[model samples]
Target: MRILVTNDDGIFAEGIYDLAKALQDIGEVIVAAPNSERSATGHAITIHHPLRVDKVRFFDTTIEAYSISGTPADCVKLAVEALLKDRRPDIVISGINNGPNLGTDVIYSGTVSAAVEAAIMDIDSIAISMGSTNITQYTDAANFVCRIAKEIIHNNDIKDTIININYPTCPKEEVKGVKVTTLGVRKYENTFIERKDPRGNSYYWTSGNVVDMEQNQDSDILALQNGYISITPIHFDLTHFKTFEKIKKLNFQK
Candidate 1:
């Protein structure tokens, strides 16, 4: 299988590097990622500026890697449309991210957005994330993601699906088990902070921490907290099914 690997944390990020290595064992892995961190960039694309892709070499791997001056989604789109035009990838895997992307946080995650973009192209994809900010042992998370990626590649029924996987910040043995979960409720406080520059120009920066909400035990965040890997099936369709029946009763055409 031919797999395309990309991330929001840039091509040099330890997470993506380790992930690419792990995935190399499964198939031909190509890495194309942002030149710098594009965290929380969501599903943005670069249209105003001409997208530039530069080939880069990292460590001993001679993989064809591109450093895009764009968001994660742009990297995926460019990889499919421009870079790998000769042979399309069988799957696209994003992340092994620096931190967890749980609940509503997926909406703001560039890591998840890359995978979503691949899925939009009718290819199977996945977003992998570690549950801790500390970068001590990302290899464990990469190994775990490799196992899931194998499953995704081998499962024909899941060809049209996109999954988000989160690994807990713990040793391999301490991991409870894998749990298929739903997005949890994430609350936040103080989204912005005001600061003054050296020239005394006032500016505001967005900053906030995720607040865990109490929900059913089957939530993605709770599963990560309990030392289990969380896997959530994500879809691009954002239609609210419960509201459809009520809206249909309005009789707008009448």
Candidate 2:
């Protein structure tokens, strides 16, 4: 199997590095990631600015890698459309992200968007994230990824959609188990601190604190908090079928 790896955490991030190494045991892994961090940059593509891709070696062994001057989604796009045009990857895995992409957070996550981009291209995709900001939990996350990826690939029937996995911030043994979950609601109270620059001009720094929202026990958020890995199958289709049917019942004469 051929695997394409990308992330929003930058090409040299510890999470991505560990993830690439783990994935290598399963298939030929090629990484094409952003040169710098592009967190929360949802499914953005580079159209105005020219996209640049450079081949470089960051690991001790020789591995095909590219530093891209684009968003996480752009990495996958460029790799499929240009870099590996003839030999496209069988699967695209994004992240091993620095932090969790849970609930509604996935909407704004570049990590998840990278996988979404691959799914749009009809390729099997997975987004891997760790609940903690610390890099120490990455090994456990990578192991979980290996297990899940193998299950999905070998099973065959599971490759048609995108899968999001968020590992809890706990020891491997401490993790109770894995749960297939649904996306939950997550709210945040945002704050803006106004400050003065060297020239005395006003500048505002954006910050926010996550406010715990009411969620079901079966939700991804609760699963992670309970020391369980959460796997949520997601898609780009936003059609509200119920609403469509409701509106269709209203008869409006032309």
Give each model a TM-score. 0.95, 0.95
Q: Model 2: residues >4 Å from true position, as ranges? A: 198-200, 251-254
Q: Pick the candidate with the highest lDDT.
A: 2
lDDT of 1 by residue, 1-254 (tens): 89999999988998998899888888898999999999999999988988888999965797778899999999999999989999799999999899999998899999999999999999999999998886577888888777888888888888667899998888788889999999998778757788999999999998776665687788998898888999999998999999989988897885
Going through the candidates in the order shown, the clash numbers are 0, 0
Q: Which ten residues in a row have the lowest lDDT in candidate 1?
A: 207-216
Model 1 clash number: 0
Alpha carbon deviation, residue 17, candidate 2 (Å): 0.6
lDDT of 2 by residue, 93-207 (tens): 9999998999999999999999999999989899999987865658878877887888877767775578999988777888898899999998899999999999999999999
